[model samples]
Target: MITSEVIWLTGASTGIGRSLAIKLASCGNTVIASARNQQALEQLAAEYNNIIPLAFDVTRQDSIELMQQQLSNYSGHLDRVIVNAGTCEYLDIDTPDWDMMRRVMTVNYFGAINTVAAAIPLLEASPRPHMIAIVSLATLAPFPRAEAYGSSKAAMQYFFDSLRIDLVSKNIDVTVINPGFVKTPLTDKNNFSMPFLMSSEQAAERMVKAIAARPRQFDFPRRLKWLLKVLGFIRALWNKIIAS
Candidate 1:
């Protein structure tokens, strides 16, 4: 059980983030939960004494600044910052919404980067500073119509991976989580088949346990990871499966 840490979690209104907030708070961590949805966050806080709701949109700089202020008001330092806030929008080649590319990238990529930037100072104050990002296995291989989502996570994967090396001097650990399909409101929008999909609660459970070890990277639901690994070798077959 990871205990007694001050954890700041974004995207905590629902799905994996909400589950994670409850799980961590149950383990004796003080959770500062951030999301655009204030009422949902309040509902979560009502259920958990340790969970403090701090609602803010990650994509907005002003919102991020306000988050930093609220975080400062809560604690002097943060042991970990989890960037789980994200959005997904599939593309249509026949008639694409060109602006969607920007929207998805803003939330998943720049928003994540901005959120992390705001917490770096507080993280540095901790004896064991750790940064965790909820990236996706979508980055491992291509999928039909996931152009924006895949590209954003791909950018996050590389950014955090590179950041791990750079942060070594400060002894800050970075753990990147690459999860396969997890059942959530976000994934519920998918019209295609999602093999080996698991519940958000289950995913959050796995994440909490695995992240305790602070590995350089953690990929879950081993079966999916292996499938992707095998598929990576046969591009034609992989393409056919996803394209179908």
Candidate 2:
């Protein structure tokens, strides 16, 4: 059984983060939910006394600092932080909006870094600090039009992995979550088919379980992981198949 702890979850206004907040709160943990939508977060907070909504844009450094302040209002130390906030933008190779790359990176990569920076001090104060980042399985294999999204997640994966080593002596645990595809507001915008797409609730349940186990990394929907591994192993064939 996972013991209750103070957990801060980003992107909790909807989708996976929201599902995770609900699950974690239901399990008797005090959850600090952060998102850009204040009203939506307030509505969610109304459902549970343990859920405290902190509204802020993850892409903005100033907002991140403000969020850290707001977090202190609830608890002096944070036992866990789930940096689930991120953005995705597919690059249109023919007439690409090059600026989209910067936008995606700002949110998915730099934004996560900012969150980590803000959470580090609070995490160090806790007896058992666990930092979890929600990355993507897209980084496992190259996909069409995924230039921006894939690269951003790849950067995030590396950042967390490296940070894991640095935080080892501090006794802080770092975990990276890679989910294949989930039906959420974010994925709803995708124009292509997403294989083995699971619901936000399903993904959240898996993530919560993984957090309890506290592994270095966790990837959901094993089939997708294997598929990506196979494609990665045969890059030439994959390139030909996609090109065909």
Candidate 3:
């Protein structure tokens, strides 16, 4: 029942963001999809009249501000802003590339912050403003070669948590979605095992439902969340279990 909501979403070229755009549009919300790939965004917008294509690179602060201005031209307020644009790159300890870490952090952390900054004014104009970020379950536990990716997501988790408290009195809800492996472009590149991997559509559905509840944190797949929680408590034991 997300009727009449003017929703702005980033990273909508593919993966979870694209799936979410479709789902939100189908649910009767006015969805503005943003991504660097204009063709992909246009294709998505073609699928539904409610979907508006907005092309911009989230990593660029000026790009985000321009996007906000464009959005303002179309709609006066944004009920929800989903900063789902993120990049994941595993760190190779052998190579120890600081540039790789910087690349990931710039897109996953700084990109999200920039989007939030740009959208805050539009969100404030809404009667019930909500901000959602698609973080990662990797933050819940340490995983090999995920040094950069995990750390970036962890930073996003903390940022959103702090934002939630600060925006509480303003009646602007902030939610962090910690998804386990989902069958998206991001996970498709992973060579390692991704247990309990769900389809992007399934993930989107879960996100839509969870967002309706307006929970501060939405960790999907109960089994996976429980497993991660238990493993987080005893890292050594979990390492042994995974190793064996």
Candidate 4:
């Protein structure tokens, strides 16, 4: 029932990005799916002829430039760009891999910037271009060991929020999507409990619905969002809970 459009989706090889690619393609969209794993992207594209696999690492300039060339040659325009490429690394204060901060920021924050840089010209060519990125609810409330991951998403949220203002003149809409816990390869690595964890399919369905609305921001699962909001409002209570 969704209208067909051209969409470029990052992190298409796994997790929520992969799920979103499938859902979008099923809805009749032509999806350019990107990821580090060429084989996985190829397999995903095989399942859906509408999908075109473009393999590259988000953190590397050379990789991003190569994909930019591919985009230029493949299509003159992109109706939407979905940046779901990111990595999460928890910080262990006691024995922290200080470099993990750099690694996470490089992909989650700077990587998204690189994607937008490549896609902006294409987006401008479309009649109604939309930019979307998958951020995390972790930014709403500080969680133990999430120093690195949460900060990256927080940066992403602000970047796009500001970018939305600048792109309005170009008629390009920017949407920042904040999702709570979802079962995926990335969250599978989490050692702590993830409240209200939902299936990636469910998350994708919600996202697609929100995308149709073209909201400037979309936060899923109202209950979890409220819970985080409440925690964020009470620093003392949040501090005590996480300290234990």
Candidate 5:
């Protein structure tokens, strides 16, 4: 029985974030959606009275501050902050450009950190504050050409895990969501096969349920989760298997 809670969702312009925003808002939560795409955000707001658009680039600290200001206009504490905003870029071994890694890290790592930092104060104001980050399942096992994407998500996994420990006494709960291949715009660009790919709606449903449980970690699709765990324990085997 998840009650209506104030939620701040990033990367809500499309894909998983957009679906999650709609799901949460429809369930009676006051959802504030953020992204650089104003038109998309506007469309989301138009669909639901509870969905408010807060457009900003997550990469900019000033933009995060401005979003915080806009949030103040709502005059309510956020029970949950979902930092779902991220970017993925597979590395081209032939080209071997560090810029590719930088692009992924800037959005996937630094951008998420900035959003959390700005939201912390507002989250602290709530009686039950929860923070969620949508990371990648690629962190569980090394994949070919995912050098940049994997490293960024791995960093985020570490960051959120550490934050969870530090915020324990403060009563601020943090959950790290590791999603397997989902059929989102982000994954649509992948040239390789994405096993057990779920739809955005399915991913959103799973995420919302997991967040309701407020677990320290949430990995979707039981079979995929088991496979990653087994592979994780046998790194050498996985390296050979994936590299093959």
Candidate 6:
């Protein structure tokens, strides 16, 4: 269990982020919950004394600098920063809205960069600083209608891996989380069936315990990872089946 540390978590207004905030706070950790939804964050804060709501919009101009300033109001040093804010949109193969790609990239790719930029300064102050981001299992292999989301998360996986090297001298560790699928309001909108669909609370619980060792990368649950690997190995057959 991760305890007694100040954790700055984005996307905390809902889904896995919300569950993570509750779990972390309950373990006697100070959780800085950030999201654009102020009312939702406020409600979460009211329920957990260890939570502090800091509503933020990643697409705003100079967001990194602004976020750093806003975060300083909560704590001086951050032991961990969970870059979880994300958005998804499925493309219509017949008439894809090209603009939707930009929206997802802005939030998932550049937004992650901005978040890391803002957190690094504060993280440097901590004796044991760690950075974690929620990338996706889609990066393991291509998926239909996931061009934008998958590409963005794939970019994040690369970014974090590269950043891990850069931050080595600074004594900060980076961990990337690739979750298969979790039940959330967002995923509820999905038209396709999700394999090994875990609950947000369950995912959150596992994540907290897993990140304690600060491994370079982690993927779950074991069954989904296994399935993705098996599917990747048989890409030719999988492609023929998925082409419909």
TM-scores of the candidates are: 0.97, 0.97, 0.96, 0.97, 0.96, 0.98
Clashing pairs in 6: none
User: Model 1 scores what on Cα lDDT?
Assistant: 0.92
What root-mean-square deviation over C-alphas does model 1 reach?
1.1
The backbone clash count of each candidate, in order, is 0, 0, 0, 0, 0, 0
TM-score of 4: 0.97
Shift in Å, residue 187, candidate 2: 1.0
Query: What pairs collide in candidate 3?
Result: none
Supply the global lDDT for candidate 3: 0.91
User: Comparing candidate 1 with candidate 4, which one achieves the higher lDDT?
Assistant: 1
lDDT of candidate 5 over 129-151, digit per residue (tens)? 99999997888888898889889
lDDT of 6 at 166: 97
Q: Is candidate 4 or candidate 6 better by lDDT?
A: 6
Q: Kindly report which residue pairs in candidate 2 clash with one another.
A: none
lDDT to native, each model = 0.92, 0.91, 0.91, 0.91, 0.89, 0.92
> Weakest 10 consecutive residues, lDDT, candidate 1?
61-70
Q: What are the per-residue Cα lDDT tens digits for candidate 2 across 46-91?
A: 9999999888687888766777787888999999999999877788
